[model samples]
Target: MPLSDLRFLALNAWLKRIFNADVTPTLISGDASFRRYFRVQHKDISYIVMDSPPELIKVLPFVNLANAYSDKGVDVPQVIEVNAEDGFLLLSDLGDIQLLSVLNSDNVYAYYRDALRLLDKVSLVIDNGESGLPLYDAAFVQLELDIFSDWLIKRHLVIELDEKTQNMLKTAFSFLIENVEAQPKVGMHRDYHSRNLMLQNEQLKVIDFQDAVLGPVTYDAVSLLRDCYVRWPDALVEQLMTQHFEQVKSSGQLDRGVSIATYTRWFDLMGLQRHIKAAGIFSRLKYRDDKPAYMADIPLTLEYIRDISARYPELEIFSAWIADSIIPAVEAKL
Candidate 1:
């Protein structure tokens, strides 16, 4: 028997035992990770069942963060049941309408404001002693940056770097790591963006939060404002950025003495770092994971890196190299 069929049979038996009745789960979708989601109707109530392979991905972090974030008033999915050894979880359904489906020019600012307000609550939930979230330290940042070079540049694009080009990347990466370390550390929903946010009954519910970490305050803000899946005008982004800037300051998450200029620089460079990592992940999803649908999003990621890197004099060489070498290679590949 195929592995998928065996897993489905195990899931079905597990569900039957839990409900005391035979329940069939309909497939919803698979996410970036090694997990599959199913919608099951039992006693007229719909629930989401997650099938995470225990060997590949653990179910404890999701359980921990779900409980923690829920306590802090974030509308995450409620955990109903769990079989930790078998990697099965039953959760309350948050519905199918993602925040991305409803956002438009007319309502983006208002909707994003509510989303940003949610971040305030999320930031307050800090890491406790041992069982807390992991730190997004300097080494972590460098490892992510390396994915761009390893997957996109070398594996997918098959580009060989000379000594000078390697040195340029080293210098640029160091600058980004410094920017990450200089910011105020807070609880970050590392992949906080439009697609992960769901709108049900006019309330925003966050999902895909298993990878939360303790990182820079500006990281989540930039992830939302300069999203990989969507783009907004510079004027609108600047307005939203300033709004978040004041929000973090008022909440005492950021120092009041920090100027808008300094905050904006942090936001821009932080976005550059994220885009660099995203481009590589997209490529890896194509070649390594056999999920090529993300390749279409790679162009926007590179465009963000190019445009943002050009704004800083220290990154001038890096920016020019991207525009001259990387962009064209990606264009040819696509």
Candidate 2:
């Protein structure tokens, strides 16, 4: 169904049921998925209406995790009403200021300190087996990597790789998966970056968390520090990572045998893996989903891949391929 029909019927029905008033929804934003969020004004109050087609998007994970995170006192939206069959929900509004819009050099340290605190609290909740989220296992990691080759390389870049380059990517993929599996498993807000976080009333409210997973401990941290949407200096990135390391250690989430050096390496390698995956997702969003705005972010994502891959011996060949072949092709397209 078109968004108009969805808004008129399913959304109206949910709003009437919840508020008993006629409410007109204003479109907020849409993510990479089929889900779209809208803002509704009712009786001098604001609420968010989530339209997630039941066939393409499931509302249960978001609902369940919202409850779980709320129980742990994490800042998140409150579900006031839910219509599972229609895949519509009425939630408490968390305002519109994304962390990205306000993050700058002057306040980055303060803002990131708060982000790390929230992350540590969430990690504690997961460590206690309270999250009940799915695992981001080796198979899942490899599947994410495959999108880079399928969408970014072949579909977007239109570059056909030779047998040797293909084999090198395979090797790099395997090595990255091994690195991911070596870390301590914890709760990951799979897309925990600037865009998904809301600064509401001086507190950060986490949103778009339906993709929460039991994954590598460093994944979300990397997603925050080495964000694809916004880039920070290397020195500031390292400093923030060190701050997270101390917090994780105090939370007792860091593995006993993993030293700070080992953890930082894991963070860096995981960042490269995620940046590669993100570049492909952005390309797929552009070519397949007709969302070209994401194309603007591919260069930074690839830069992350190129810079980090060159520093490791195991990824020497992969780094060379990116520098010599991938970067030039992507740059020319941009």
Candidate 3:
């Protein structure tokens, strides 16, 4: 039998032993990482089964973070069974309506308010300074920033950066990295966006949080506000920012004497770094991972970079290069 078939059979055998019932598992989704998820039906109940090939993906991080979030009263999946060797875990299903499909001008206010509340609640435990989640520090930030130049610029764009352009990127990246590292660090979801959140049991539940990191407080907020998947109006985003800042302040999470203006700047700059990283990753996913559909998001991500860069004088050269050179090249290819 093929390896995949063997793995499937083993997964079923394990499920049967755990539930004491014959179960048929249906594929649900796979992410950028090495893990795949399935929904298993056993005795009229639905459970999410995570299949992480132990050789390719480490299951311990997900397990540890899941326990930490669960203890903090966050709405996250409850672990049912874990097998580290085989890399299978049974979990409670958080239902299907993702925050992405339901968000609109009509109801975004209420939903975002709930999101900020959850963020504030998370603040309580994020700084335990002991969870041992990997630090998302300057090195990680630099690695992500380099992806744009390595994958997107070289492989996808098919253009070599001139010396001047290369220097501009170096300067731009250094500025972004410095700004990110200067912020208050905390336990961050790392990809807290609409799609990773589900409206389950009339409550907002977070999912896909295994890569939680000790990073900037604004990283997740930027992921949500300047989401690549969905766009929100600037006015509304600013309002939500105010709401989040107020909640953080009330929770004693905000730094003393940090004005809302400064916080907003941090949020915007953090988003620029993330957007740049995402642009490269999306391109890499298309070329290397055979996920071409991700290229659809590149234009929006670039738009974010262009808009944000235009606001900072230091990024003017980089911004001009993007508009004069990169944008046209990307448009021609697309």
List the candidate 3 regions with Cα displacement exceeding 4 Å.
1-4, 127-131
Which candidate's lDDT is highest? 1
Alpha carbon lDDT of residue 70, candidate 2?
Answer: 83
Winning candidate number (TM-score): 1
Give the Å shift of residue 164 in candidate 1.
0.7
TM-score, cand. 2 vs. native: 0.95
Please list the residue runs of candidate 2 whose C-alpha ends up more than 4 Å from where it truly belongs after superposition. Answer: 1-7, 125-131
Ranking by lDDT: 1, 2, 3
Output the better candidate (1/2) by lDDT: 1
Q: Rate the local accuracy (lDDT) of all candidates.
A: 0.93, 0.87, 0.85
Score candidate 1 by TM-score against the native: 0.97
Number of clashing pairs, model 1?
A: 0
| Deviation (Å) of 165 in candidate 1 | 0.6
Q: Tens-digit lDDT track for model 2 on 83-136?
A: 888888889999999999999899998898789788976664453234467788
> Hey, what RMSD does candidate 1 come out at?
1.4
Error of 1 at 278 (Å): 0.3
For residues 54-112, could you state the per-residue lDDT of candidate 3 as single tens digits?
99887776777787887888888988889999999999999879999989999987888
